[model samples]
Target chain A: MSVVLSIQGLTKAYKPGVPVLKGIDLDFDERGLTAIIGSSGTGKSTLVRIINRLVDPGDGTIVFKGEDLSRIHGRQLRELRRRIGMVFQEYNLVERLSVMENLLCGRLGYLSPLKAWLRRFPQEDIEHAYQLLDVIGLSNFANQRADSLSGGQRQRVGIARALMQRPELLLADEPTSSLDPKTSVEIMELLKSQGEDNKIPVLVNMHDVELAKRFADRIVGMTGGRVVFDGLPSRLTDDHLKLIYGGEGWLQ
Target chain B: MSSASIPAARPFESSLGAKLLALFILAYACYALGQLDFSWPRFVKGIDNGARFLDRMFPPSFKNWDQLLTGFIESMQIAVLATFFGVLISLPIAILGARNLMPSWATWPARLIVTLCRAFNPVIVAIIFIKAVGFGALAGVLALVMGSIGFVGKLFMEAIEEISMKQIEAIRATGAPFASVVAFGVLPQVMGRLVGFCTYQLDANLRNSTMVGIVGAGGIGGTLFAAFQRFEYDFVLAILITIIAVVLLGELLANYVKRIFNGES
Candidate 1:
């Protein structure tokens, strides 16, 4: 399989002395699901954010396709980001916008200001949005405001929005963290199927070990801002869990 | 638990400086009243003069109804036109003034423009505009536009600033252009409040537009001032009544506009 994304020596620090991501490296391939499992505050979300450049890195190199992400800025950065879809833990839908509008938000980068202000999206884009609505099983909620949707339904719209980008790589920053166990599994399944159907690599940050094991072909365990384990889920043992979670008591 | 286990209270004391300041203000008021010659005899005579003024203001004369209608209508036009122009201009100013969107250098200048517009009273601005434009309703409209920009623009900027950046980040991450980010991320959150502010500014301009005419900036106020100068107190009273009626109508119109855009309604 072709390498979809490559990261080398990625480091970020809000303050000079305390670093969040301290010299990290990663490589993602163009198929299946890869889950990043780690304890709370292990910089998992920051890693995904840096991949999308939502939060800029202090020092690093992210080569997605052939372009170096860290060196891009302005319109180039925007274009790169559009091709890489992202899903947030909180859904992050524009609450005031209608469900249909929220789904089409992914196309904003492709439309002109005049077209966006007038809400005159291309006909094909609108059709795809409607189709995605059915795909996500929320066809009846096209006109309803996003704030009126349940957490699960909103997250579904969130997924549809990311899919609207027709992304090469999908980055989900703890997408199931706000959901219940059943809902979390359902979302993971939805993500897994979407990745397979689209033939795109899905990188998910997760806390649930069993869910990750069930869905991920390979699991990357992170601890203290560095990758501690990178292998098939079958190889992630109790010893590896201890190293990733930083405690023996919680492993039980 | 024993009943006598309570702690003793501390004594409360007032500051001597506060008491002395109060006494000084009281003495100053008395001295100022004396200087103004506000005696019992003068007050009684002033009431007699007020009675004469009220008597002349009775049965408000509508003999100059044509002039009253024209002046009042002009004032209404000035107010509506000024408010429309002001709100149109303020949209961009508000965007520029948002701290999250613009750098400090840009926001500072945008804020300074709003502050300068707000610093002067509409009447004072009318006087200056009247001098610049050589009188008439044009000057009144211009003055009120400045007033509208200052008040409405500042309010719109603050509303924009208060929007959730999380929504903006989500939109930006989708690879939206800066303009698209504003339309999708920024505008939806602030749209309802912007409409409310625009309507409010319109109502305020309607009120100020009447007074701007007194400075020869053109409105019913010019005619009202002439009536006062000529001792036609009844005619002045008619203009005042008309202004009150127009202002009430404007308030009703503003509320209707707000309702139309509320979406919930």
Candidate 2:
């Protein structure tokens, strides 16, 4: 498989001298769901955010699609961001807007402010949004306000919004953490299927180990801002989990 | 529980300072009443004088209907124009003043402008505009516009500041430009409140439009002031009745516009 993104010596600190990500190095495949698992405050969310430049990195060299993502800014940075899609833990859809309008927000990078304000989206974009709605199983909820939807339905809309970008790389920051167990599995299935269908690599941060192991083609376990395990899901043994999570009591 | 061991129950502790302040206020009120020559006989005499004034205003006259109609129309025009222009100008200024949306430099200047606009009452603003623009509906419109800005701009800025930043971050993540981010994320959140502010401002401008004319800024207040000066109490009552009717109509119109814009039945 081709490498879609390569990270080398990536490090960041919200405060001086106290780094959150400590010289992390990893690679993402072109077209498989890679789940990163770790305990709380393990820098998983920070790692995901840094890939899209949502949270700035202190020292790093991130090469994605042949360009250095660490240095660019202004128009070039925005252009790069348009090619990368991100989903949030809270399903951060515009609550007051219609579901259809929220989906069209993914295309804002291409349209001018006046066009967006007037809601003059191109015909093709509208059709694509409708198709995505159908895929997400909310085709009839096009006119409904986003805030009126349930948690699972909102997450579906969030996934669809990310897909609307047609991004080469999809990054989900704890996409299913807020969901129940059953809904969590469903969301993971959807993410995995969508990634395979679009041939886009998905990098997901997750807390649930079993869900990650079941859905992820490859799993990377992290602790203390460092990856201690990187291999196929089948290779992640109980001892490895203990080392990554740093407790044997929870293993039982 | 032993009474001696338990601490004294002090659920409601009243402040000595508060009691003293209340006593001071009562003493000052009594002193001021005496100084102003307030007495039972004076109040009785004042009531008699008010009754005689009311007797003169019993029969309202609308003989000069043409002049009243012209002044009323002018007032309406001033109100509509002021509301439209004021809301238009306030939108951008409010956006700039929103601390969350803009830098401190931008917010400081925009907030300062709104403060200056709110510094004077609408009547005082009308007098200033009347001096600058000369006596006409234009002065009235300008004065009401300042009042509208002061009302809507500050409130709208606060509404913008209170929006969920998560929605904005999501839009920004899509690589949208700054303006597009605002158009999609920020405006949608605040549009409902903005409609309410605008309708309320329109209603206020309508009422102020009439009052500004009394200060020679234009509208029906000019005619009403003239009748008052000439001791035409009957004509004054007619003008007052007309003003009340127009203001009621304005309130109804404001509600209707608010309902339409807010999508509420």
Candidate 3:
């Protein structure tokens, strides 16, 4: 196994003294699904956001492919971002645009603004986008506006968009929080398979313990902005859940 | 649940200062009416003059159709050119003025430009342009362009500001360039409203183009104003009908644009 991403001494604060993420460290060794579980406001979302620099960390070194992500700027930063695909919880598809247009957003980094404005994405990219739409099971919805889709269908498009990036690592922040149980399971399965198919690590931050246990290859439990348990799913017992979530009442 | 309970204080309490303020406004309105000589007899006399003038205005004659056609065509040209250039220029300015996207320094200058454009009326701006450009449709177009920029630019900035940043963040996550972010993320969120605004601006510019001509800018208004001064009320009536026809046609075009852009009626 080889380390893909490594975070050292990660710390962040929205206010001067109130830290949302304390000093923490993490590493992804092989292509697998790793779920980070914590209760609301326990910094689960912040943890994933820091990886993509969506939310900057106050103090840390995020090393991806031997380069410190925090130190990069401009074109280098964009190149680094290209290697990491992030699926948002709210789907975030451009509502007014068609599904195909939104999916082509995955290739925005590669295309120039002039090309994008003229709808001149490479022929291969357009074909690949259509293929991804099929993979996400919305082949006929290519021209439909994003706002017309259901919650599950929209998330499917969201997944398709991220996959279009062909990233080295995929990050999903509470991707299932806005979905129903059946849809959540289906989305988790879709994400897990994409990680397997691409041979890239998938990092998911969620609060649904059962869903995580069912889908994740490994689970990292967090509490009070710090990792309290990191191991295989079978090893995450109720005691650890209590420690991570700080209550046994939720177990019932 | 607490319907029987009495509240500690009245809900719609009118402060004493508010009452006094209302009274003062009423008193000031009366004083303003007196200062303007807003008397009933004056209004009656004005109505008598208007009645006679209206009687003379019946049976419009288009005997001088060539001049009327030239002025009408010029006005339409001014309106179309102004809308095209104004929307083009204001689009970029509005994007720069969006505070959520750009730094304060960038936003401030763009906002200031838009503010200055909107501060003056089209007629006043037309007069200034007429002086600089020396009485032509160029002045009318320039004046209306500034008006369109001011009106549409502010609305566009507000539309950009109201968008979901999460959409932008998703695009940014793809490592897209800044221009691509705006093209893919920002523009889509506001394009519909922006298009609606552009159509509205075109309609407004059409109406204002005619008015600007009165100030020696250029348009049908110059012909109409000359007819008025020459006491050619019958010709004046002809020009008014043409203006009304042009305005109606412009309204139809605007509605068509709106429907096409939004894909709805």
Candidate 4:
């Protein structure tokens, strides 16, 4: 598979001496969902955010589609961002806006502020938003306010919003953490299926090891700001889990 | 655990300083009353004068009906124009002053401007505007606009700051421009509160519009002040009643607007 994004010598430190991501190097393929599994506070969220330039990196070269993402700013950065879609853990839909409007938010990069303010989204975008609502099985909820939706429904809208961008890359930051077990699986399934259907690479940060193993083609385990294991999920054994998470008490 | 060794429970803590302060306030008030020569005889005479004043104010005459109508129209015009311009100007200033949205360089100047606007009361501002604009409805409009900016700008900036950053982050991650981010992410969160602030400012401007006219800024207060100066007590009474009615009507309208914006039928 062709590599869609490559990270080289990535390092980040929030404080002067304390580093969150310590010299990370990885690449994402153009297809399949790859899950990064780790315990809390292991820089999983930071890694995901850094990829989208949400959190500035201390030092590194993030090469995506023949461009150095770390160096871009202003219009260039926005242009790069439009090509990448991120699903937040909180399903951060604008709560007071309708579901249809929230989905249209994904198209804000292409529309002028005046047009967006006037809510004059193009016909194609409106149609695509309607299609996405259907795909997420919320066709009847297009006019409903985002705050009124259930957590799972909101997450579905979040995913649909991301897909509205027709992004080349999809990044999810613990998209299932706030969800119940059953809903988590459903979200994962939707993410995987959507990724496959769109022909876009998916990089997901998750703590649920079983869900990751089940949905991901490949799993990368991280701990202490470094990747300790990278391989197919079938090959990720108890020993690897012990090394990545540390301690065996929770293994039982 | 003997009863003798157990400390008595003091649930209500009283401060000696508080009692001393209260005593000092009462003593100062009594001293001040004495200094002002506030005795029973003085109070009785004041009450007698007030009764005579009330008697003169009865049978309110609307003989100056044309003058009263013109003043009312002018005041309403001033209020509407002030609110319109105030809201228009405050939106950008509030956005600039929002620390979360703008850099420190932008917020500092914007905040300073808002503070300056709020530093003077509407009457004081009216005086300044009258000096500059030469005594008309324009002065009243300009003064109340400043008041509106001070009130709405500060509250709107606070409202912007209090919005959920997560929503903004999501929008930014979509690669949306700053304006689009504000349009979609920020505006929706604060729109309802903004409407509420605007309606309240309109209500305030309506009241202030009348007062600004007293300073030759051109509203009903000009006519009312003239009547008072001439001891046209009945005319003054009529103006006061009309003012009260107008204010009540403005309040009812403001509430209706607020309700509509709040999505209430």
Candidate 5:
């Protein structure tokens, strides 16, 4: 019901004169799935990354949990990050580590470096990891190396690893882009259900318009870094799609 | 028409300068050989002496078994100790040297230290350390530690450089501390490769330990050198056999270490 993450006039430009995110403004609620849908090079991924501060915004105010994330640095920034979780397009699980170990890595911010290095995780954290693995349907594969899993299974581990943080907010950058259609739907469903179950906002950047419509409670469409559409999925019409993607031939 | 059929060809002949350079190198090699008096007679005489020496090396005698045993054990100790400390020290130094991980200023100092350590051959390093530490396993250990930093440190830095930056970015996004970032992101990607480097360095240190002793650094090689000076060829043969056996045993142990760390293995 309340704003969990508030972004106001967020801007990013890799080159001084060439701005990638011209000026963006959006607010994320504390529950349900919010899909960021846009065509390629529209700065959807950039917007998500800026939210997590993986890519620094040129100028913006990102106020999350009453703290301005853009202004924070050092230990304060790291502490802020512990409350937020992020997933990647490529899954990005440490390939050499076991699923159990990779899941525990979500708690890396909470553990001492010496303890993490020694794999001396707290019993509660280990129990929570196992519970998360079970939730993600990867209980039997906990001891298996991440690289040994299939695309969908690896993404499951990726999700479980993020959930291990017990984060207040979740950001997934194209979580199902590499998967097959059936697997993509399954991953989307998992993400949607988990977001609802945890009562946390999950902001996902996706190119699959149909998949986004199917799962998103609210759809935010962008073009050239500006919000073009912000409403329920049912309200996203052909006119909105034309504006979000540009040109009518692709839709046909 | 296919793209392959396009004619963009040229003559594949060497330029005049290249031909003359080749000719000059051949001439210089011939002149150098001539100055060195590398004739068939000299080669034949050398072969005859080699044959006589080979004849003397046969039928190895373990006349002083107790002394040989003590020397062999010391060689093993020197190898194990040097390898353990060398790999231990190289881990953090290698991380600091990685160009991708650290700034150029930091990498330069780390790289320079590794280069200087590797610049001297272990035998030369052993000679210097023997002078400093007064002739024992301590000198042998120090020399091999330099060797380990030279080899494992550089190799470990290379391994760190080759890792996927995308993985690191994902971890950093979590807002993990610097140390946590290394433990979760950097170490996982490089751990298997680091294990491989350490075991190979250990095997190399095992072989070099024998040679360091010849500089009076306390190992089986010192005993073998003394036997050669005294014309105790049979005792020397015994020491050589012991060295070969030790090197092979170290190789097997290194393989086991690799297996334990390699996920698939």
Candidate 6:
């Protein structure tokens, strides 16, 4: 498959001399899930955040379809951001807004500010939001306030909101961390299926190792802000786990 | 259990410093009372004068009904108009001052404007406006608008600052422009609080408008001032009672507005 994204020598440190993702090189081309698993504070979130431009990379070059994502500003950055959809750990739905309105937020980039302010979203977007609502199994909840939803329901809506962008690439930052096990699996399934169906690469940073192995087509294991393992789930040995996470007293 | 392992049985203690501070406050209060013209005889004479004044004000005569009616209507108009204009102006300033959404360059100026508006009392603001715009209802409206912006703008900025950044990020990631991000993400979170601010400004404006008239800016205070100056104590009492009634009515109306905007059927 042709490369959709390529990251070269990505290095970042919140404080200088203590790098988070140090000289990391990765590429995404295939249309499926690639899970990046690491213990907390390994800069998995920071890696994805820089890709979304939510966090600026200290030193690196991110090329998405031959465009340097790290250097673009203002209008160019917004145009680039449209092709990349991100889902947060907290679901991030506008709490006081209606479910339908929250979903329409996916199209906020497409509509003018005046149109959004007036809530005059185009007809196709409204229909698409309704369809996405059904896909996420919240058909009757379009009018319900987002705050009334459970954690799982909100995450489901969050996934749908991301999908509404029709993004070329989807980045999820520990999407299932706040969810129960069942909900986590369900969310993973939704992300995987949507990734395949839309033919968009899904890059996820997760804390749960087994969950990543089960759902990911390819797994990248990281430790201390560096990638330690990159291969299939079968190749992810206990030795590799120990190397990635360091010291396995809890593994017993 | 060992001493370190076992938690303390008593988790609370009143410090000696606190007790000392309380005693100092009490002593200062006693000293201040002694320094004032607060003798028992002075208090008794004051009470006697108040009773005599109340007796004269018993039959509150609305002898000049037309003049009273005009002043009352003018005050109501001033209050309503000021509230409308003030809330509209404050809305943008509030967004500007929110640290989360805006940078320091924008927030500092907006904050300074809000502070300037709030620094002066409404009567002081009214006198300033009277000097600028000439003695009329226009001065009252301008003064109250400044007061409303100062009071409501700070609260609005605080509400905006408290909103979830995740909400803004989600919309922004969708490729939405800055305006759309604010419209969909920022405004929804703050709309309820904004409605509350508007209603409060209205309530405050209603009271301030009448007072502004005393400074020759406009309203019922002019009539009240004239009555007091003419030794028409009964008419002054009538005006005072009418003011209290209107303020109470305004409170009820404000509550109703708040409820309607809160989306309670």
In candidate 6, the residue pairs with backbone N, CA or C atoms under 3 Å apart (3 or more residues apart, or in different chains) clash, namely A109-B175, A109-B176
Q: What is the TM-score of chain A in candidate 3?
A: 0.98
**Tens-digit lDDT track for model 2 on B1-265?**
5978879978797799999999999999999999999999999999999999889998998998898998999998998999999999999999999998899999999999999999999999999988898989999999999998999999999999999999998998899998999899999899989989888888888889889999998889998999899999888899999999989988898888887876741
> Alpha-carbon error at A24 in model 3, in Å?
0.7
User: For residues B9-95, what per-residue lDDT tens digits would candidate 5 score against the true structure?
Assistant: 566968999999999999999999999999999999999998888789888988888889988889888888988998888888988
Give chain B TM-scores in order.
0.92, 0.91, 0.89, 0.93, 0.88, 0.86
Tell me how many clashing residue pairs each candidate has: 0, 0, 0, 0, 0, 2
| Model 4's interface RMSD | 0.6
Q: Give per-residue CA lDDT, model 3, range B51-169, as digits (tens).
A: 99999998897998998999989998999999999999999999999999999999999999999999999999999998898999999999999999999999999999999999999
Which stretches of candidate 6 lie above 4 Å from their native place? B1-52, B259-265
Q: What is each model's TM-score for chain A?
A: 0.98, 0.99, 0.98, 0.99, 0.98, 0.98
Q: Candidate 4 lDDT, tens digit per residue, B98-187?
A: 999999999999999999999999999999999998989999999999999999999999999999999999999999999889899999
Per residue, candidate 4 scores C-alpha lDDT tens digits across A1-65 of 88899999999999989999998999988999999999999999999999989999989899998
Q: Which runs in model 4 stand beyond 4 Å of their true positions?
A: B1-20, B34-42, B263-265
Question: What are the models' TM-scores?
Answer: 0.96, 0.93, 0.93, 0.95, 0.92, 0.91
User: Which regions of candidate 1 are displaced past 4 Å?
Assistant: B1-12, B260-265
Shift of residue B207 alpha carbon in model 1, Å: 0.7
Q: What level of docking quality does candidate 5 show?
A: medium
Superposed model 5: Cα runs more than 4 Å off: B1-12, B34-48, B255-265
TM-score of model 4's chain A, to 2 decimals? 0.99
What's model 4's TM-score? 0.95
Per-residue lDDT tens digits for candidate 1, residues B1-265, read 4646856644675689989999999999999999988999889999999999999999899999999989988988998899999999998998999999999988999999999999999999999998898899999999999999999999999999999888888999999998888889998999899889988987898899889988899989899898999999999989889888888988899889988888572
Model 6 over residues A68-168: C-alpha lDDT tens digits?
89888898988888889899999999998999999988988788889988999899999999989989999999999999999999999999998888899
Off by over 4 Å in 3: B1-48, B260-265
lDDT of 3 at B160: 95
